[model samples]
Target chain A: MTDAIQDEIIREFDGLEWLDKYGLLIASAKKLEPMDEDSRTDENSISGCQSKVWIQSYKRDGKLNFNLDSDAMITKGIMALLLRVVNNRYPQEIANINLYFIEEIGLKSNLSPARSNGLESIIKRIKEIAKNEALKDNV
Target chain B: MTGFAKDFPILEQKVYGKQLVYLDNAATTQKPNSVIDTISDFYRTDYSNIHRGVHYLSERSSERYEEARKKISDFIGARNPGEVTFTAGTTDSINQVARSLEPSLKGNEVLVTGVEHHSNIVPWQMAGAKPRAIEMDEDCNLLLDSIDITKKTKLIAISHVSNVLGSVNDIKKITEIAKDHDVPVLVDAAQSIQHLPLDVKDIGCDFLAASGHKMYASTGVGVLYTSDRFSDLMPAKGGGGMVDKVSLEKTTYQEPPLRYEAGTPHIAGAISMGAAIDYMQKIGLDKIEKHESDVYSYARDRLLEMDNVTVYGNTDRMCGSISFNMDQIHHYDAGLIMDKMGVAVRTGHHCAQPLMKSFAIEGTVRASFALYNTKEDVDRLIEGIEKVEMMYT
Candidate 1:
């Protein structure tokens, strides 16, 4: 399914060279709210990534909200993009949405198991969180 | 320095609209044209399973394989070709030693330096042995006089060069001490085989392990040099070609090198190693060592001169790799930006978690050098570091 936010991301990255893309990502990374040291504990840390990544989630106003942070700027930048597409969305909506922008923006290579970026692992964790939240809503 | 960059066809290419400056030689060295041609030529002509056939083609293939073994045997100064057994790589060779010496290594300790890579650390753990790091000072220099070998220290496995920090440990001194204690020592030469001239006999180590890929040859082939003292060690792996007499109740294995080689080996890869050795020899190891040392020192000096960068590990003699980090910058981020600038480097713990713990840091950006890399590559790396620092500012 076509997503408006995903399409917008693809358009934003269009016609940019590799260095420019990285520059944009670094800027987005800076825009993300800093994660506190207490919240960046081992429990919140995501393993299998080359960089240190932490994720937090909570339900607000019957919708799921998420926050993610990484020590690496490019990784945090990608997390910023991901939050724009899925934050504050209903659990059921998040569980079924396709993040095609990752592929369209020349980042699909980083999602492979071979690459140490752990982009796939982050996406999986997001889906798992959405499924659990959706199940709790049903209960 | 010789114009070796032209010999590697892959170095001429452009990455990200810039000249690719490869500084990840510690991970793997690029193969020369002679090595590449040797692999293809072997496949085109002498492509057959070795040591098991009796036909003309089999004889030719077996002859070529043994010839490669002889070349390798001489390259590392083995007493004879029989002392060297071809394995998959350095990890495989180390695991073979661990497996063959399982009876002695299990429940014992293997003394290692604080700067060993995981390949040297993990195999001993998998073999049911604990790895204890020898004492080293803050600069990551091994304090040989402070080495404590206990009764449980059955073996000492150390790396000749640190893959992450490029600290060259004095394995010869360790061997001398190990001899007095009657404890066998294993030298991991995966990082040293390409950059420095090595002699197993001169080093007096019981076992030495090195990889073909790291020495500008093909992957899937390596050498495990076992001293004649360990000739009777049990085979780590049991298979068809390695066996001599097999029955329902009894099985006997082949002798020395063939005894360790379990199945059909990488025939072409081994031949490629022969070509790589020939290529390096023709260029002269003395010349290669001098050139690489010059380039390596220049790189280290330039990185040290950078005010915003912190270089890791210091030693009187260092080569192959130099790890550094910029002020308030993550190594992964620097590596990503450097990749865009066509300066390929390695970032992370570099499979040396213990070393990382000693430094109390997550990781560092490692720029490893090879014979082909020149001062120009180091200049490119400095530029990449400048770009990262500017981005942060």
Candidate 2:
């Protein structure tokens, strides 16, 4: 399933120039579902990012849903790209899945390390949330 | 001079099929061939430890290193080479002073300008001193009137030029104020040294720090200049080469500069720094300063002409850097687009988060000029920014 998603993302970005990829990311950001103002709290905020980013997750019918936003357009766009691979996926699947889409799409090196680190943190936080949700299901 | 740009080899490259327009001089400068070759040549011919080895290589290397020190001393117009101590960089230099002087602080606070880089502020805080920031005007100019250097104030540290704003602070006046209060002043000259002709004697500050990398030299070498009075302070660190006589009970230490150097210094970096100073001398700082000022003003004027473009800094005082933002455009987005267009500008807070927060901005796209940069480069930046605006809008 992870491979399928990674392949889809790679296919989506294949043969696109750097500017085109950036435009697509920005377009994805424009299409992202806006999170409630109240949900954008410090608890959901991620540090070590040059731009401000917030991610919130909730469990629904054994699946975890994610919502993320960033103050900077590029950061928001990157977050939107990452979410396309993991959002609305099962907790166990999300907890176990390794998203290689960033590397496959050449985004791992294309963007600055700070933004890449932010992407990693977003993924890490999502996985952590999924892992917690999986444990709660067992309990 | 057309031949001047040829001195820097890295500027020859093309980025994304476009000739690279490097405007990130404030971050770190591309080294000229002379500085680069000096580093390599020193390693190839004269590589040895100084102050201890009795061998010929040691003596030659030591003499070269000391020669480098004398060059830097002359470069900054210091009273003597004894007043200059080589450190890793500006941050290391400031930390050494802050740590060494912390024990003697019989006061409640250390005063710093609000526009200081993190390097200047963090040291005083790390040394357990309460750092009170002197207020700046809305335009980010230091409000000299807001400075309250009271009896409780032990030290006043200020940036000679603001890293973000590129606004040259009145260090001489600030130093005089500190003098009237009998408080010592430390001037961080990291931003000013490259674009301005600096004379420590004229500045009249007790201490000053500057990095070599910012001035066309290799990294890992910087200078801490102290007046004769401040030179009496104890060494910041203790190590092998800095001692005169090592005893079981007590070890006699060397004097001020050597005392603070403490360990095996950055010999090649220091030598290369001297080469860099030589390069700057050959070009003449007065000429470089004027050229940069003209280029910066030209860029600022052109940028201001653009609709909804907001440029920062006091234009009358800016040396070689300009920070600006386009209407409703994120700095990172603009920076990314500019990068694609092969114009390297720094985006983000520029290690001046306090200054950014004061202006209620996340970051600004900073296009800083070097002596090698021409009006053509500024035009390229202006065109690239226009492209970014078009793409985003």
Candidate 3:
């Protein structure tokens, strides 16, 4: 189940020190494959972030894929954590999942309110993309 | 005074299983128990509408409120109590001047230093006046020689101490320059009032603005000091309390201080602010200044010792703040890490976006000190920063 992936992320973060959560996020971000420059358009951009961030979604064979990037390394790291849970998953599953890893890992507590707001925006954008993909399948 | 941190009840607490080390004084200071008690005592005992009430509570409240203004008048060394207007903090106070001075500006530019908070800059811009920033030196000190106070300059505004750089400006010298140009100067004393013994007369600035919450008082209260020459202006906002006589055709406004204060004033906030001032006066500004300078220098020296850290501002005359950034580390990330370590510091542009742009940085982690902050707090900040760097490695 997709919950298993979430559990694994929670366990990994829980084992790290309170400060190391950011480092883990940074490392996750660094490991993420870079998005194509063409995908860095306004449609793929996430607003309300202090740092410029981009997220693109595509549907292939009933599975949704997401590519996230940010000018800020920490933000990119945060997006990578989200991508780990929901990327290459079914549209409905990606849309329905709560992504509790954010709350469970104490990421929100570590980040400023503005950063959290941006994180929320990123999640919302991801869900929006997934929901649209589901709507396209129905059509 | 060595153990003065005990006076702040909030400082004794813990955050995330660690002892809280609050160094974000530039944002606002934690109130002392005396200030807290004064506010509660006012509401519990003598809560009433000020100025026009015939009842005993009203008389007592009115007397206490005016007395508080007098205390503030003395605190900043303003010659007349009437010259000091109670506002809803520094932003509101500065806006009052902006609105009042706009029509008189007649399209002239408002000269402000680059180091001002947005509260100092946006007001002038909002008043339909363009703000011309006096550039800072490469070292981030205000470049006085670069200040061109021409005939087109309607007003010159500067912070007595920069919230970002913690740089204490030579207000007396700037005021002298303003005098030569026949331009009135406004000093935003929000950062300086808590750390320095401010005498408006000594500085010779035409106007000064300060906030109460930044000086160990309750929020929603501040003072605007107006010189005798420009003391009275038309009311920016008109309401029941500010008017002397009102008819359908016309209304006559009250004097300088009352004219500016509209609606039911913050009686409790003012009284509590007076108590906060009393608290500082008892400790003595000279002693507080000395303690703050010592902490600032200690923190700056410690931060400078770290090879990766780039500390901002000239330490020679700075007070109560140490703003810096570590190499290859975002200020927001460092701030978050510091928060986890129970060291509260300010991050982001600190409402000085222009100043940040000038420095070619997005932001810096700012650790601003107060009377309650000790050398130990600075050590925690240093430790928190080290932890941030270590995490990235």
lDDT digits (tens) for residues B291-333 of candidate 2: 8878888988899899878988663477767899999888888
> Which tens-of-lDDT digit does each residue in B1-393 have in candidate 3?
237888888888899889999989999999888999999999999999998899999999999999999999998889889989999999998998998898977577899877879998898888877889887777667788767877778999888898988988889989988898899999999999999998999999988999999999989999899887885687778898888899999999888788889999888999988999999999999999999888888998899899999988773488866789889887877887789899999887888998888888978889999998888888998899888888788
| TM-score top scorer | 1
Candidate 2 local Cα displacement, residue B315, angstroms: 5.5
- Candidate 3, after superposition: displacement of residue B368 in Å? 0.5
Instruction: Determine which window of 10 residues in candidate 3 chain B has minimal summed lDDT.
Output: B313-322
Tens digits of per-residue lDDT for model 2, A1-139: 4577678889989998777777777777878877778888888898777677898887777788888998777778878877877777888888998777877787776434456236667777888889999898889
Index of the highest-DockQ prediction: 1
Which pairs of residues collide in model 2? none
| Candidate 1: pairs in clash | none
List, for all models, the DockQ compared with the true complex. 0.80, 0.65, 0.51
Candidate 3 chain A worst ten-residue window by lDDT: A108-117
Which regions in candidate 2 have their CA more than 4 angstroms from the true location?
Answer: A110-117, B1-3
**Model 1 quality (TM-score):** 0.99
- State the lDDT at A116 in candidate 3: 35
Better of 1 and 3 by lDDT: 1
For residue A41, give model 3's deviation from the true position in Å.
7.2
Candidate 3: where are CA atoms >4 Å away? A15-17, A34-45, A50-52, A71-73, A108-117
